[model samples]
Target: MPDNSSYLVVPSSVLWLLGFAVVSISILIIATMVLRARRLRSGMHAAGATEPTGSLLPEFEKNGQSAAASLVQWSPETLRHILAKELPDAQVIVVSNREPYIHNRKGDDIQLVVPASGLVSALEPITRACAGTWIAYGGGSADRLVVDENDRVEVPPDSPSYTLRRVWLSEEEQQGYYLGFANEGLWPLCHIAFTRPIFRASDWESYEAVNRKFADTVVAEARNERPIVLVQDYHFALLPRMIRERLPEAIIITFWHIPWPNSEVFSICPWREKILEGLLGSSIVGFHTQFHCNNFIDSVDRFLESRIEREDSAISYGGQISLVHAYPISIEWPPAHLGKLPDVAQCRRRIREKFGLAEDVKLCVGVERLDYTKGILDRFDALDELLKLHPEWIGKVALLQIAAPSRGTLPAYQQLYEECLHRADDINQRYGREGYTPVLMVTEHYSQVQVYEIYRAADVCMVTSLHDGMNLVAKEFVAARDDEQGVLLLSMFAGASKELLEALIVNPYDAATMGDALLQALTMSQEEQRQRMQRMREIVRDNNVYRWAGSMLLDAARLRKRVAVDRAVGAAPAAPGNVISLLDRKRVAAL
Candidate 1:
């Protein structure tokens, strides 16, 4: 007992030395922690882990406001750089129903054809920029002939910037999955069109089978396990989850290119749960508008047993979280097909001559697929009413209705075409003189350059969809107008309407109002046209297709880097915030 007391009472010099040593150790630990924190911050910044400011718009974007000039105007070069930084070794793999270029048989020689599809228009630039692989359905007659053993063909025929992998589907599979389920079921179900969605057991089976097949193809085509897969459109709603189940590490960005109806409307689908689950399998689910994003979240909430985080715009389901965001789709700025486009004046002159019209005749154009959802009949009705209300426009204006026939086998579309033709005939008969046709229908598919030429030539471009995602035709009309001369009559229901506010927004359902809008467009002054077109051009230029792709990829990049950082620092996602406790709180409290 005496020895213990003596030991406890140390010498004064020894006590001072012990105290100095303890302080030195404490200082060393603090210095080490400070240095480590600095290093951690630097590493995080280098890894592209931005501070959580809770904003979706990147630094480069600023809503096309004149006060806020874009730091980076998105281009092919910028997109390539973004891909290099964000994705590094991983290539972008696009899963789509339509190919950028299709091989068709013309006699014995195989000819390449670019499909006249909005989906193609939106995605081709990204594929070309990244030199990435496009996985699409091989519907072409000679698609099998052009591809190598891997069913891969270098596209754009002449330049060959990217490879297109063809996935073959049998007739039965195509009919059931594409025509029956996708076109008939999902298209009508999603669109505000009056047609009813036809869901068959056979079609659902084929849809599932096709999605599974595409997923398997995607997995095989992936350069790495964690490839950036962009699942495109309603054609492949089940694809994201199918890809997810196979390649758990893959980052899937599923873009719903069509308008996502409200939850009440979405409940019309019989297999709504499956669709919601499939979409939630994605890392990010992109829509054309915030309204659509809300609709999607509402749908998921209504149908699924998922954790909804509205503040974060995220859904946690099946041990994973999916972020739902609106990335308004757009056409390419200085579109890829602008290489050989004639000057605007020349385009107008040529188009007037092509249509056998006088220079004074106002050229109004409508470019879309011949689908009921496009409101082609409504456009014709509007024109009919326009001529009736103002008979002066009867012979003075021409609506060059250029429509590529789509889903022709469907009764709704076939009926729409007939109705459109009859309506066009009635308008032409009632209005047209010897050489003036008010409604001229071009039913054949036109190439991108051809469509651009049309867009450039028009005095007015009518994108009167009853319900639409971001109508690229509206953007295309804006993008094509270097002269800033045309008027864009966009439907209020179109997602582009919300962005292109300068456009004469009209409800496609209201033919009388649209007729008046058409009249107003025809009567709009050149100065007013310039102001509106200039503003729209700015919007389209600032928010082009590359920006759309870049924005989503940037988000993906942040998410990827965060996951990597968490894993590297042994940060458990399930743990509380600030998981890495370099200084033990319990020890500090005891001290």
Candidate 2:
């Protein structure tokens, strides 16, 4: 009121200042976003530099509206070329529960650590075959990623891998997702042992959220017209459908790393139909064994009650959707060359010293993750019973039990660990004479080299999974033992049992059976062990991991037949100077 003219001037100046502040704030925010985007782009670019990209996919519509069978018979190379074309800018995104490469981010730099997955050995060839990108979620907060000496992010060709973002679960979320959903529910349910599965809505909700995050990542990474996405295992079961909805044109492939139970067992899942539909959304679904594939097909038909036409290698449902057939897994045998290394000999000696073993004790080794499903308790009980029944041979033979720690956070796993420890202690207490503990039980995990050495030195290799998708360990042990000397005591329940029938089979659930099998194996003539090992090795060597991968792709290609056709159309009108005919065909070629 005292100075009207001066007040008006002050108000105008204040307005201008406010406007400037708002503009500055907006600029800063935009700058931050730009920097973040650049960082993400740069990371992807580095990973993709070595990959192949282009529109190599066949225009299926242009391929004469052929049926699924006709499509499979197409030349493998041609089909891959077509697929490569479709994914012209194919950024191979490999999404899994575990990170493909563990990045140790320290300030402005990053260090990558790769895990020792047997799957890697089988898929590495395909990864190396194609140019692609890779993404993955790494080990949980505590366990550091296990890196190999190679210092390379090992992956297949025609694939780019990257990790999906997981909201580093709080302690509560972890319990619900890992403990409640994965272990308590899916773990037991999938194994057809439903007594332990406890249904929880909240835990399942968390699992859904986690899988959605993975879907979001795939949607964000995939290009509009040319994206082929591959999802691994059960952790992200709903991801295929989620991504399918967003990227309708993209080709999705889902591979189940675990066994899919039959109708009777699968019915227990509260969301069984949802899982089946989620998988069905993919253009292709792959399983480790034919039985698993058949089980999945049965689930879809029984639950969905959908009309399915089963062909030789594939199943066509409702004509529009085709569920392709064939097995898609193999073991990475650490080649014969590995045996020649000086370090190999050294590792064997180290294994002997670490366990304090004498040269004469016939070492029978069982190396497995310390999980309840591994039948570790049964193994211990069997060993105990064996020693009790046959006291004379106690010191003559040692069961080298290497129980590698896995999923220790879960209560069930922890209980298993405690039980294992107690069993080991009891055996040592009962059997100890002067120094040697009959059961050389190792709770800690050894390096891959050490494991290889253990496999080489053992007179017998044991695979005793209660319910396994495919115990590649059985195959791996056989591959490593080129001498074909070790007798393999395989569990009848394991998927590997279907493939490895020559080995000594035992019902892991029955301690008596296991003990008997063990005794038979121990006393088994050296010649018989060699013969069985030889036959198993031949099968593993001949089929090989490389052949397994190639077979899948080949089967996919073989879905349809390829007929020689001209680049230009015959009956249809040609554009201006470009006239062509189907009659002007070249000789058909094999892929």
Candidate 3:
């Protein structure tokens, strides 16, 4: 009676409906959590099973006969055996921008230097095992001196196992194709690290021309009709399509070794359609994670009118279905560098002596190229905060930053190099005493042995990337610490975080939290370090680079067989002179 309309009383039926909806939502969330828990439990239980199960190559039936499912103890030897068995007639061809080994002029002699690249580290071992041909741009100073008349040279000067085909690029081509488009445009676009991507028509043109150049080289290098081509990284996105167009029967597997942005983010790129279409030309498109694969699929949905079969993770376009999958890249187990490094005690003592630091002082290592996306500034800022917050650690804990010079010609990278030096200098000025520098910044390129020595020496290894495909440094750290003593502070943004579960995952954006993580790593007990490191080691060991390569190769083999059957049954037409990869070529030759 007293303004009942203003009181806004709900009806009993409506109230019941609202309550029921709320209950249903809550039940759904709880059920989801319960299911997730059950899955984790089941996985843990399955880990104890003695029966062999395929962890990478899934059980697939062909022509009503199922392939025997067996878990591979993935090693270099095992990988070779599998490669030989999977595609006996095909060649293994690895194509990338950076050569595995660089020939630099060292005074009067040519020095065979291995570039500090995660790509090289991962693929070199596989090539060695398979005796594959690695085709890359010849950017090194003395690259032309060692190559034969055919622009090819056998690598591993100590023990030649594979061919290194060098593709010469002019100064303009290097500037526009590599530093301009690849790094400035695509790299920053893919990784939203606050830097605006610089896209130019000239850079795009050069990129296309370079891709064409590489494609011609690839076609010329193909000894077999259908080579198993592994087109590596962003630099070769267009190369896949170029090769596919020419050699329709060639099985091209393109592995994007970087993070793929969401549709909205990728929409900013003007050539997004071309890049997407180029990538789709592969028989398989691989990313470091499923999240990236999803982002790529979403981008393709927005930009291209391709048929995306969500169930199979395959994209159909131009009468071809490209299988998109996650192949988490990893470092080699018992790293090649490991055999060259000294014992932990010796490493610690020698590094401290070299740096003129006391033995008791803690050494924290952060290794990266002088690139903004690596969050080197954030790492320095976090260390600065840690020192400021904890005065007791002022002279006790030191950060040894190992920054390798990369793309110095780029304005952004040059600025980063300067800023990092200034920042390190400021911190040192504020906190340093004679023989007690809080921050030791080394910018010179270090060999694998020296890097591994530092890894073994440091009590903590920090990889704080703003965003990364998969920072192999994290895995490399775990591999180097076979003594199971070092702690790894990894960025949550890195793809490696998904695999290295035992690492101290921190957000690179949060300085305070990262500082705390550093403190935690510094103060962690030896036993705890051993436990965490042991877990990471097992993960790295089981899922090594050999396993990574094996997984891709296995999937490629399955697809090849499928295509062969299709052709045999006249379901698919055959192209003339088809078949093989850098691996397929060398491995077939090796066979």
Which candidate achieves the best lDDT against the true structure?
3
> lDDT ranking from best to worst?
3, 1, 2
Candidate 1: C-alpha lDDT: 0.82
Put down candidate 3 lDDT per residue, 232-258, tens digits, no spaces: 999988988899888888889999999
RMSD of 1: 12.7
The candidates, ranked best first by TM-score, are 3, 1, 2
Highest-scoring model, TM-score:
3
> lDDT for each of the candidates?
0.82, 0.62, 0.84
CA shift of 546, model 1, Å: 0.7
TM-scores of all models? 0.86, 0.73, 0.88
Residues 1-591, model 1: lDDT tens digits: 355654666789999999999999999999999899766644332222222213321222335432221446888898889788766887789999888887889999988888878888889988999888999999889889988999998888878899899999999999999999998899999888889999999999999999999999998998777888999999888998888888777878999999899999888888999999888889889887767888999999999987776645677777777878777778888876767897999988988888898988998899988988888888988888888888877678989999898888889888988988898898888888898888999899998889999999999999999888877888888988999898999998888887788999999999999999999999999999999999888878877888788877877775666557556877653111121221122134448
Residues 1-591, model 2: lDDT tens digits: 476765535587899999999999999999999899755533322211100111111322343332232223222243346445533445555566665444566655554444446555444434444444344544443223333332124332124432233224456666776677877888877774324777799989877877777677677656563365657777777887788667754556677777788888889889898877777666567776666777888888788855454422233332224343435355654453355544434546676787788777778898887877778778878887788898877887788888888878777778888888888889888987775777777887565556677888887887888888777778878887766677899997776776677999888888887887888888999799888988887666545555444443432332221111221333332110001211111112112
Give the per-residue Cα lDDT of candidate 2 at 263: 86
**TM-score: model 2 vs. ground truth:** 0.73
Number of backbone-clashing residue pairs for each candidate, in the order shown: 0, 47, 23
Off by over 4 Å in 3: 1-59, 62-70, 573-591
